[model samples]
Target: MIFFDTIGTMAIGSRLRMLSERITEDARQVYELYGVGLKPKWFPVFYVLSQNNEKSITEIAKEIGHSHPSVSKIVREMSKDGIISEEKDKNDGRKNNIKLTSKGKSLALKMENQCFDVKSAVDDILVQTKHNMWNAIGEFEFLLDDKSLLKRVIEQKKKRESYNVEIIPYEEKYKQTFRQLNEEWINHYFKMEEADRKALEHPKEYILDKGGHILIALYKNKAVGVCALIKMNESEYDFELAKMAVSSEAKGKGIGWVLGKAIIEKSRSLNAKKIYLESNTVLTPAINLYQKLGFKKIVGHPTPYERCNIQMELNLG
Candidate 1:
């Protein structure tokens, strides 16, 4: 006989039931607002298009983590409802391109605003809960995994963690090495004029002042990379992510991403609202790493020097 009164069975059943009911009710409400014909899952596809307009079906599916067939089905239904349009890909004759129709675009905008309002309301509640919900869910997942399998995975991680990469707070002793790395990086990637190189080599003042911090990544006691965070203003809590350069000898060891994560975590600890970075397109690897870390492209304000560069920002608040 099945034991319904067991703690594990009852807990799992209760949670699953609650989640199913919540999802069903949300889908029903969204369908009623948009139209009885629209599937709630398609809303994410619409939202992605609304942000980055005109993506192929494959791109849409990948971004939304849905299978191509599923996305195709949703697109076909939306096309029939006059909510979206499909076209043949010019470059790839076999692929079908997708974009939002006038009605779909309008609905997407409304949905986006609704999502923002919902997020704001949820944030207020989450502030009090302090992310307890997420912690509970994580604990449940951990419990579900086999103990032996989990121990093996954790042991593998510990073995890899033996590679020691020390990040030291910047000090007078390491200033020369930091400048050397920056100079080498500029010459390698940036076609810096003599004056520009000088400016970087000898800034009027160190990038980080009061309420600012710098870190130098040391690999086996050698200074391999340097990064800085400077407090721009109190209200905005802006910090400049500057002097991020790795030694040529130390390229491609995944050091850059490590330094980036460290800087971001430190900024969060300092209660920063946002972090801004200036970089050039020539540094494709760096730009890719930044995007992977959730930094978005934005317009740059006037700076001390003239370098054709791209500016990126991350909202911490």
Candidate 2:
């Protein structure tokens, strides 16, 4: 019985893999009956080499639609079994060329049209279905040239995950998100003091109203991360990059990277000269990211937050 058989089309991939495995095993049985020591997986490589004279490993691999490593492994096994010969190319000694041995050549001649036999059987069975399996497979292969099935599937998943995340300007609704995201980290490692509360509670009055910019990261239209660039030193176009956080549940989806880029772009747009950030040594992941984005550790900078230990600055000039 097929597990998940009820899912039908949703389980096509598993069904295809299972079907391939079953057909491959049956082909192995056919080879045994013919007294040919061959595995279905080795068919492509062996058949390609049989048709070509002393082809290089890479040439055979590409023609057979297998990786060089996979072809190499099969070649090694075939060479050990005395069915194929491997040697340095006559013209280019650096390249390894492969060819069917006398034994392999004999089998190839005997097995001529044998590969077609299995296909013909499958085709006969598929005749009962309204759909043409060969034509469908050919179309599927054509589509694969544009994009592999695995790649398209992975990209779709990433798109779905990314669709849930969006970075936007600060709003009244997100005042609490900024507080909760930041507080989650602060409360875990250090106590939230008066300075933290004042900024978190009255962001519009204290931060945004002072020509500062704040950004919020939304996941499914809900705030999950937040960061602020507070304008500083009236004469100097310096901005303090502070109060950045990604929610515990939303961490590690490149959300922190997205927020950092947004803040940097906003600071640049505001004609800022430099961005300084203060953090603790324990937040290594955040620090590493900051460093990757050209933030350098600097000494002698004073910070009001008691929890702050490490100071880093990014020169936008």
Candidate 3:
């Protein structure tokens, strides 16, 4: 069996590179067949200059989504071949405006016609195949634009490492662990206020007895995170998500996200319509996690803690 076949989807980058090389080879042949005076790689820069008449290397890079250095390298090669010429920018003396030569403009007209035939051939191949590769590539690029491949892979890595983490209901044995986690984060940033002391010191009396719920995340039988859902009496929100904290050791293991999700599910199970939260902008990661859980910033809410500068709510209904 082939090495790529053995690796399956792991060879996606290699497979796409191979496919691109094949298409580029065909482009070279097509250019020769039409007797067009343009290199296969020069078509992009040539086409851009044909339409815009003038552009700087930075503009070309932004338009084609290539790196500045790569575009500069291509521009240098095209200039050496007499396909493009550079003139100093009228407004910016330091920048050079790139435009096509007379010979390049003539080649552009021929390549434009060549493109129509190549497009038709691609369409024919699309019809012959079960799936449309063009549309598939567009959709895949759209997804990558929304969330990069690096971020997606990091999330998967977090999930794999957090598979052993278990979320469990509050118990007497975990009371101290809960306080320790919350206090570690609180004292690291702001002073522990009276409201925080009341809730953390007497969670059973201040939170649990008031119909609130606490959850603890256990990693390898060691408690690493905690969150509380305090049942609210307000008309708009049914619960207030509070007292959420994760151990510094388990920071990137997705413990906060998992604890947050479990708390949200608990609120939903309790027939909550909206869940509210109060936070400070200094806690950027926490705020980001809330947003990822569909929470939106809200205003005009009073808070007992001095550190509460921002409020958000998630509408489950």
Candidate 4:
């Protein structure tokens, strides 16, 4: 039924592992037929030492891009079989140097012919296929190396969830909700300072009345995130992004991203050339979000909040 085809990309790892095992089984059979006692798993290390007969386990691991412990285990197994020898380093007692044994050297000579045969067979298969599997695999590895599978999936998840998030302008009805959301996060991280109370407790008086704006993120019709852009002197930063908070329940649903983006657009609409913010390093995720939005870290800024340890500015100019 080709279950993996039905299950789709979610089973990609399983599919690839299955393909690897199939190829390994074929190579194992071929090795036995050719009277070569080498295991397919040992090919990488064996081929490496064939090129450079003497290398430390660390060096081999680096050359092959395998973990040190994994290489160590393989070395131990090959040593047990008398296919490789390990000697204590005279310069560094803690390190062991690896080299192929007499038997392993002879096997390497035989494998050279087998490698040519394998290459010819692989070329035959490639001609029969629509695309070159090696090239596709190389491209896939390059992309995964750039970002990682986990990070790519998280980005997709956020993109999917962002559709359900709605960013709306602030109204008097959302005033208390905004304050509650900010206070929820503040109280959890650090005690609220006087500036926080003045801003959150009376957003209209301290922020809005002075040419500021607020944004609310509605997750499925429920308000769960808020951020404010307080007007600053036009000569300096035109606006300050502050008081951003998202409800714990909606934390992983990309509500924060939507609110931040909306706030930045709001500032741009007000003809702001630059935006500023104050935050603590302890708020790592928040700091990362600001950095992602093109904010650069700055110094020599005074703050009214004791919890503030870092300052950032985004130059829209």
Candidate 4, run of 10 with poorest lDDT: 230-239
Local accuracy of candidate 4 as per-residue lDDT tens digits, 173-237:
99999999999989998998899999998999999999999889998999999999998864489
Deviating ranges (above 4 Å) for candidate 3: 26-38, 91-94, 106-124, 155-163, 209-211, 231-239, 268-275, 294-296, 314-317
lDDT to native, each model? 0.75, 0.85, 0.91, 0.91
Candidate 2 regions exceeding 4 Å error are 141-222, 226-317
Worst 10 residues of 2 by lDDT: 154-163
Model 1's TM-score against the true structure: 0.46
lDDT of 1: 0.75
lDDT of 1 by residue, 56-150 (tens): 98899899878989989888888898888988888988987888898887777666656675568657766789566657767876865646545
Task: Give lDDT tens digits, candidate 3, residues 1-317.
Answer: 38788999867888999989999998889988999967788777777889997999999999988899989999999999898999999999999999999878878877777889988999999999998998999999999999998899999988997898899999988889889988999999999999999999999998999999999999888899999998788558888999999999988999899999999999999999999999999999999999999999999988899999999999999
Clash number for candidate 4: 0
Clashes per model (N, Cα, C within 3 A): 0, 0, 0, 0
The lDDT of model 2 is 0.85
Per-residue lDDT of candidate 2, residues 176-228 (tens digit):
78888889999998999887887898998878898888999888887888999
Clashing residue pairs for model 4: none
**Model 3 scores what on Cα lDDT?**
0.91
